[model samples]
Target: MVSERAAQVLVASNRGPVTYAFREDGTLDARRGGGGLVSGLSAIGTDADALWVCAALGDGDREAVRRGVAEPGVRMLDIDATVHADAYNGIANSVLWFVHHMLYQTPLEPVFDAQFRRQWDAYRTYNRAFADALAAESAPGAVVMIQDYHLALAPGMLRELRPDLRIGHFSHTPWAPPEYFRMLPDDVAEELVRGMLGADRLGFLTWRWASAFMQCAGNVAEDGRIVSSAPDDPRPRIRHSPTGESAFRTTLVGVHGLGAEAGFLRRRSHELDVEERMVALRDQVGGEGDRKTIVRVDRTELSKNIVRGLLAFRTLLDERPEWRERVVHVAFAYPSRQDLPVYRDYTAEVARLSEEINAQYGTPGWTPVVLHVKDDFARSLAAYRIADVALVNPIRDGMNLVAKEIPVVSDAGCALVLSREAGAYEELGDEAIVVNPYDVTGTAAALHQALTMPDGERAERTKRLAAAATALPPQQWFLEQLHALEALGEGGEEADDLGRT
Candidate 1:
């Protein structure tokens, strides 16, 4: 295994910093990731250098070719395809993600068995692949920041290899309550918690998730000492820093926010054929500006409650006959985890419900529900821009970025109907129309209220929605965590990296 010496900071995730694409001429290009990852790095600034290690997702990566403009100091580690599949499709995304998202059925047995053990070994190997690459690449005294559940076991695995590194692990997803987490096999549960404790610090998206981690540590550690311990110490410090941005301070308002590649998402929008499609759609369905467009976009994942959202939309149309002709619900569900039977079935159910609704209320000139089950970012952005009401109802989520992202770019100033169960609710609760995710009737009523809201009230609410999404920006979120890490300087090398604007 070839290893590089080390650096100041390290980032490890399932997907690498850049994705590779091969061209006809045998040239390659890389596209960076979206969301908080990009935002976080930009916030790291020029002075702070980070070594980012992630698995390459395609053939271009397997061939060890780079496409597009590669960023400085980003290292890509490509793992074997079988190891990737067993670790990702078998364990992390399917098992751990389902557990953390509370997407599984309590009635069905979700136990760790021989097959699970085999996958567990693969999972360990998968994590070790990244850990090995990181250990080789890291500089002594580097702050190793491992991301999400995909590499939950990487912290301990990496620590075993490089004890000198100051490690930190952040969970982007919600941490399940201990009771729910205890479903895992004894060794699996114990090892996973111990794996995370190998870090010097642990970060979570919300205080609720942080509390859950502490509770799990209390149950699994036996020693009640989960968060902190001294050098030769086996435990790490735990902290909760729910991210937020001030709407008044965004680029739109000339205030600094986590500067995203807004230019990128903006340029990508024009390629989607969304504008042309929207015009055709309006002429076909709206009939001279008659229909209100309600948009909901999500990956067809279990926690998204896509099926429930569709049911509510159908119910709303049934309850309010007048809206059957006047409201068009555009549900853009991007396919996710088709390998998982539950996700596959749920996605099919979404399609079935949409078909049922449209069949019940379709006119030769109009369709009540337009459902798109493919992943297309440009179409999503375009949908966001036109939405009169944006429905974001997650059964459970770490944070619903869509709740924040849509309002920032919504051309029509959409009213957000958010689920109280989502972590984003903590920030958007006041401005949004909150509803219980499972209560289809209540959700239906909320949709009705949102669609029928007076223009003056809707405009006021839209302003608040936009404000909440922009407040923290991705750049600020990353800085807050970095500031926290800086405060915990190696044995009193402390300096206030906090109070950064």
Candidate 2:
């Protein structure tokens, strides 16, 4: 809007739809990225006048911005690299992520020393940069959507700058319960809650997480009259105001379970690259004699519970000896957050476990476990198609899309072994063999059940899973949020369908 091209809808996040990289010849290469958000933005069409604002993450991106490089419908902020690193790595990834996922060891971890306080300041500044940019670029009453924990503070700051703009914030990660969330410094915890409360509406992936957030918000907010709905209520409401005054800060909370785009996945899996990968995976699996395959694809994040999943697979083989040569585990443990020492160690542990399993049960003709660390989308889809059982067990997740995806792309059908902690459990638990992530024995049992399920039953379950999983696709999920924001009238009353789960 500063340049007179005022955008009607704006998206603010840590990463943009476009990224810049340098080729070997030293020329800047601008390439677009794709995901639910990208596809959803595209669905808005040209008339929406959408703009994406994101941080420049690398040297190429910084150079692109400095050289006045441009991408339509996108703006990249060249924040100071050091500040970004401290805020991103120190606070967002280390502190907030750990707390939300309940990853701390409690006895020896989470020492909030002076260094942490400094990083917290940098985090505030990082969020301020985004708020300032959003304020500068937004048209009057523009709908701004801030995403994830990276910009938790931005919504409140943006409200301070431009009160007229309709603001919404969505948390893509689990919301920690009040007890675990209070581990942060009291002042910091207060700031985070107030920051999120600045938005007119807040979204979580499931009712469980949305209710958890309301509990945490009510526990804090000293001056406000915090009115919270019951825990089991699908449409929970939270309003905050001064003790004697009417409700001034009415934040409608909602849960929008984002489903995979079935049409895209079904079409994409049939492409040439995917077909080639399918041939390769099928050859590797060698299902000629009815050998079964269990597929799992995830980054080596701490909360993903990759190590436990591997151990469960090992147990499945150890307890059921007759299945040693009858099945193979196809694991895609891609590297993630390698810059963090903990993540690197976790990834190494995964490799060590895979090697141990192969050494224990693998023969030359049949590898017991085929582990791939590299990221290849086609190969993942290929694995999905060939899988007889799909494993999606995470310690905590906002929503495990893989659990919903495999059913849509499987060649015949796939029995799902899912985690109770995943948001998808609320939707797919009836058809999935659910297990607690911490119970390796139980998870192995669930795996056995999934692998041994009858073909007719597997086909029936997959059909139902696919139907429920595709009920609200990604584009509709995003558009629903926009519609909710637009439906907020000047009178400041809740819409009829504003808080539907």
Candidate 3:
């Protein structure tokens, strides 16, 4: 049933654990990638017998592929440039991402026609490249874990290639409900669900998303109907056709809320670089005296709701005159996906809003908003440390780790004002001042509440939030999924047993 020579585990995702950059001297510089997935894999330790397969995203990566360069435990696949662009920028980001996040205007957009079909074909080819690479690298009975919406089709594609391998697919984004998911063409919706059903175990960030997935599958599956034997049970079993034959021998669906590495954050928050930046930030926010600092650190992505966050801050100033000179909003709006026109426009809007607020309520001693548009991790950690309140209001997110990270690293307890729509709300809602992402006035009220929160109450809530955020660290998170996949290879009952953990 097993081969000693085969790799014990394989991780597949759009981006790898490490990325290569070309230096002026034409030499490759390897830098570790950043994300929850990378952090989880790193927690598994270098001793684990695992291979990570990822696509070459840039020219440096393509050149590295040409040179046949390999990282310690990584395999890079060089797909055609045009196909990769269409699949990633066109279909994945522009189409699928918009659909899942429910970000479309509905009436004017999502016009899927001949061009969409071409991009969809390229998307298929892109997934095929990854499936072929994973199939080639995997050993007999190896457990393969595919990550995120980018590779939604890989599980089914890989299953067709290697039935012996135990496959699991984890969705890092929130799954759209059946009604919204039906926006896809009939055939495309069915194919997407069937692709994911190829996995032995399907994992999501929350049970809500898992239920949504089951609903979508039920609506799309012509021959299959999903039935929950127990109403209260979070897990749903799908039974296909009149024969009652289950597809893929029972796909175990589960919820694993990804969290930040508290141990790492605790240690890194006090480093010299972070300390230096923290001092500068304190001086910037509290120029003359101690003023309350409301900090928001996010990429300038549309879903992050950065412009609305700025608007809420403006509303706070207009409604509550006392906070005009006593509070400062330090917004670190880092640039992300600059090549995309929509992202560029969003970034410009954030800048415009921040300037409008500052121009409207400017004093020599206090500026309403201090915005930074660059990538600086140390600076972000610095902001986290000095933050009196951390604002995280994504419209729809898988799990906003920043919501968890701020509470863990804040020097003085920070009040968290989180969006109800964020996936993090499932875990941190009890302690956070939750606001509707679309309500600017409500969010402004929330900000005022957070800023005026009592010190003792804030400290107590921070402790509880930190405990819940890091309950299952990255190491345990990855291992739990691995263990579930391994158990599936053993038997259905064994997988269910592991799932209970």
Candidate 4:
């Protein structure tokens, strides 16, 4: 049981540990949180007092929520459906999201207006709900950790209620540079910057992202100073928590472990309609059996560089005739943000390229490319299990866990063709075939090399990959943060009371 006397650490984010679903009978079902959420929280262990407070996704969430089973000190606050719709579906996902990912079209340009303001109000309301909950729940001098861009305003909001609270906020996404961040209205940007500044410590995934945040702070702050920096160097005193799995296991079980989607992946993969998908692919490509199945799975987003990847595959088919009989690319691109015209257009282009490649190089026995547009995690895991080569080439990612996940779950000794730009390159680069995301010919050559690598070498690489992927599992990720928080608490008051600079 959590007591008021126990030291508390509250983690606030957009999504919580439980999601609600309405059944046929209209009763609600609550499911445990998946992916990074599970991993990070589990790592904290039982010794430390921690609570994960997150917004309820829907009205069903309140009915579905399993009161106390999720974890220690976990709380799910129910907000209005409109609050989530405008804040998450509107401002956060559609607007600020594209800004951070650099997914906007320069020709069309992004505009902020009354609609944005209304949505921004909802965003504020949602964040405040979490802030109010944390303020009430947190003990004096408690350490409050906020996660991701969705709750950027929560730190300050929480701080207002508990000035003595030791606060920290961590950004999981890539921070946009000053130029890209300037797209937001001046007041909105200022609010975001000041909101995050409420934290005593700020965390980012990489130094590059940290630098970007500092640059944005410089641009928006009144006196051109962030965290009391010199006028010429107006930057925040931010910390880089380049989270990773343990160096020993190659799995995310220990130091770097985020959490296991393995069971989820395995269970889900068994039922997904991949056989029908395989049949459709064969029919579309004219039943080609001798071709290589080069598989790529991603949400259809701008940063994924799906169009460029398809162009590279096309280049390979054009330049190398031998590959024509030996290669088939299976692209499982799930639709994301269809309401956004830019995303809709990008999805169309990906489909157009897939057709052109098949028409140009495909024969009755071999369709050079097969593209499936739907969200199917199980089919994706199944593909990972059998893929001879896995291509994950993102333009810029904080950490593409797929680069790590594929190699762990792959049954065969799969070769990884990764983008140099992906954050996972820091860990998997030694074993992966690195390529420039923009270079079509280069990526094709990498694909060829991955396909042709010696059997002994491939096995060696896979062994190393499996070791790396499981090294630091999800529990470790959470525990490390808790440990850091505890250390701060132990030393914080003494330093403060002493007035040590």
lDDT: the better of candidates 1 and 4: 1
Identify the runs in model 2 with alpha carbons over 4 angstroms from their true place.
1-3, 231-235, 241-247, 287-289, 490-501
Q: Write the per-residue lDDT of candidate 4 for residues 238-319, one digit (tens) a residue.
A: 2211114111100000013242345544555455475554455545534344445677988888888899899988888778
Error of 1 at 462 (Å): 1.4
Q: Which regions of candidate 4 fall more than 4 Å away from where they truly are?
A: 1-7, 45-49, 62-74, 222-224, 227-291, 339-341, 490-501
Highest-TM-score candidate: 2
User: lDDT score of model 3?
Assistant: 0.85
Ranking by lDDT: 2, 3, 1, 4
Off by over 4 Å in 3: 1-6, 225-231, 240-248, 490-501
Tell me the tens digit of each residue's lDDT in model 1 across 1-501: 325445677778887667777778887766766677766776677666677787876798766533334557677666778888889988998789988988777787576678888888999998898888888887666677788899888977887787667677788888899988888876788788878766666777666676677777657645433322111223233321112422110000011123234444556555648787666556645757868988998998889998889889989988888887788999988888787787788888888888998898888877889888878776777787778899999999888888877777666678899998887888788989999999999999999999989888887887787776667767676766566555554521332222122
- lDDT by residue (tens digit), candidate 2, 191-284: 8988998888899999888888999988876664665667666666676653466635678888899999999999999999999997887678
lDDT on C-alpha atoms for all candidate structures: 0.74, 0.89, 0.85, 0.71
Worst 10 residues of 4 by lDDT: 246-255
Q: Of 3 and 4, which scores higher on TM-score?
A: 3
Global lDDT of model 2: 0.89
lDDT: worst 10-residue window of model 3: 492-501
> Which portions of model 1 show Cα errors greater than 4 Å?
1-5, 25-29, 45-48, 65-72, 223-277, 491-501
